[model samples]
Target: MASRLTQARNRVVDRMVNAPRDTDERALRRAVAGKTVLVTGASFGLGEATARTLARHGAIVLAVARTAERLDELVAAIEAEGGKAYAYPADLSDFDSIGPLADKMIAEHGGIDIVINNAGKSMRRSLDLQYDRFHDFTRMVNVNYLGPVRLLLAVLPHMRERGSGQIVNVSTIGVRIPPGPRWGVYQSTKGAFDIWLRSIAPEIKVDGIDVSTIYMTLIYTRMSAPTPSMRKLPGMSAKEASGLVTRAIIGREREITPWWVTPAQATDAVARGAVTWGMGILHRNSSDTASARGEAVR
Candidate 1:
């Protein structure tokens, strides 16, 4: 019975997050063929799948990640499949290094046609436990917000000069949903970028550069592995999530979110007070349970 329920939930989730229709690979190929695209966090998960998919569709994929070895393997695999790819390993969190990396990419590729800001960090530690761990907030903001912004600032000029480009930000649904306990760090950082991108979208559009933000839900990836409680929850696969990114690339939509997200956001806003109170109670219960466990261990 539990297995059946899980399967049903998975089906619902798949429908919610998956693209409204199957992407025509032929169309994707035509859109990206011979274009240079940059994908961050390309070592694994959604980024890896996106890089592979874009490369297969004839894009010159510049795969960037911290893992040089894994990126080399990805590039080699793409090459073996007759796809064009170049692995560029760099730590996104290292703010000082971004400018040089951008220069190198521009020099090599002449300019990027598309940029997928998919690199980010996720945290789920309770606020109570993070009382002394301020680094949690800083780290997340650096990687999730600052890193992407810096990279964009570095590349935006080049895109502007060409008078054509696309920027796809892989955001999270948490930005639109009610603020949840234990996710303050993650949500805030993601929210920062979401707002930043929205504010700049119109301005960039004037320069003929399209901007897209995909408010992705839970996806099965290494970043989501730490939250064991979420393991059984309905989530999209990395490949499915990658397809949505590709859809955004081809369609050039301003925003892509789950079909149910609008209603959920409306409900959350309407019941804000009650939701906050209930979340407070849940937080207290979680804290009490943890204290009890500590006592039992002692």
Candidate 2:
């Protein structure tokens, strides 16, 4: 009886997985018409959705990710739908490889009109764990902070020469809230990117190159397997986030997000203690879930 129930649940999950592909929720025809866009981490989650949307709208997309198979699949899907795309596989964690990666893309498709620096690392770890796992913090910064900076450096020269470009650095809302008990490594690394982008935005603004930092809320993605409370809170869909991203790139918006962001930022400023306490409650629940899952895997 238990096995039969498990099989039934698996079948339901399979149906949900297959449903999105069969009926085409792709607004690809309208979103990216006549744009050349570069999306980092295009193998999965938000990056993949943005890449697909841009392609469907008639933009030529350059998709980069560490996973070759996923990139290949995305490229094939775009081509099958009568859109243009180029896939490049290079791990964002390796900053040294960024120069050649940019060169290859330019050689293949010319320079991009917009760059989405959306590739990042996110791991939730307690402060107590950091002493033994400082490498997690180091790696996170290398990929999340340094990688995007290097890519910007490489691509900006072409964009400047052409006299127009946009870069959307996909940071997170975690910097505002500092919601913790975990994410000591993740938050610090992403915070570094946010600060650096703000500092450098002024210098680049004069060149017709707009640098926009997008602080995102929880989105529906495989990586965003949140606790019950977070799941209950209103989360952004990848599709909705893609719309905001498109608006920022095409219109050169200074910043883009849902209206909730203003209040979230204010709460962080005036009542940090209360917010941290609230996060503690959530993290406690998350830790138990992670532990149980870890034990089951073992």
Candidate 3:
């Protein structure tokens, strides 16, 4: 009975959070065919799916990730399907390496037509557990903020000079909703990049560059797998998440937020105090994960 009740709640939450999006394959082909597209985090989950879909539509995919073997496998799989892809294995968290990676891509491809900033890191640890781990904050900031920014800075000039490009940021819906406890590092880092991109969108618009931010909701992947509670929640599949990303590629919408988010944002604005109090109560009742508390999983 308890399990059934949990499942029922998950269904309700999924319905409220997930929105249906239609993608016209013809449109996607028209937008990306023969174009050089770069996808970060392409070794697994959503990014991997998105890269494959884009390649199927005839995009010349540049798959970027830290795992060389996985990236090679992804490229091989794309090739087997008569798609074009090249593996570029690099760590997005390493700020020093991003410039060289971007430069090499530019040098090799002449200039990229689309950039999918899909790489990210997520953490959910409370402040008490974080006091001894300053690197946690730095790691998230590096992966979620500075790294993407550095890559963009490297490629923006080339895109600007050409006067045509597209940048799709695979951001989280957490940045849109009210702040919850234990997400301070992740949320703040993601929020910083979101704001930075929005601020620069106007300046780059005149250069014929389209900027799209997909504020995505939960999708079960390795990133969320470590959290036992996330496994019980209703979320998108890899294919479903990739569809929204490809839709963003086809339509170039400035922002693709869940339909429910706007109203939730409004409610959050008006009931800020109430929301804070409720979240505080919930946080107090919840204990940190074993990993967050620096303990063994077993």
Q: Candidate 1, residues 1-298: lDDT per residue as tens digits?
A: 4698888976776786554533789989998999999999999999999999999999999999899999999999999999999989998889999999999999999999999999888777676667777777788898899999999999999999999999999999899878888878989999999999899998999899999889888889988875666687777778878888998998998888878877778877899888789888877675423332232110
Residue 202 of candidate 1: its Cα lDDT?
89
lDDT of 3 at 116: 96
Best-performing candidate as measured by lDDT: 3
**Tell me, what's the RMSD of every candidate?**
4.3, 7.1, 3.4
Each prediction's TM-score versus the true structure: 0.91, 0.81, 0.93
Report the lDDT tens digits of candidate 2 across residue range 1-298.
5698887975565333211121123443443567689999899888998898888778899999899999999999999999999889998767889999998887777777889989887776556555666567677888889888889888989988888878887878777654566766778889888898889888877888888766777776755663444566555567756765666565566665545556777887899888888888877666534532232110
lDDT of 1 at 167: 96
Model 1 — which ten-residue stretch has the worst lDDT?
289-298
Q: What lDDT tens digits, residue by residue, belong to model 3 across residues 1-298?
A: 5698897986677667775554689999999999999999999999998999999999999999999999999999999999999999998877789899999999998999999999888888889887788888888898899999999999999999999999999989889999889989999999999999999999999999999999998898988887788877778888778888888888899988878888879989999999899999999998777777784211
Q: Each prediction's Cα lDDT score? A: 0.86, 0.75, 0.89
Model 1 residue 96 CA deviation (Å) reads: 1.4
Candidate 3 local distance difference test against the native: 0.89
TM-score of 1: 0.91
Between prediction 2 and prediction 3, the one with superior lDDT is 3
> Ten residues in a row with the worst lDDT in model 2?
16-25
The residue-level lDDT of candidate 2 at 15 comes to 38
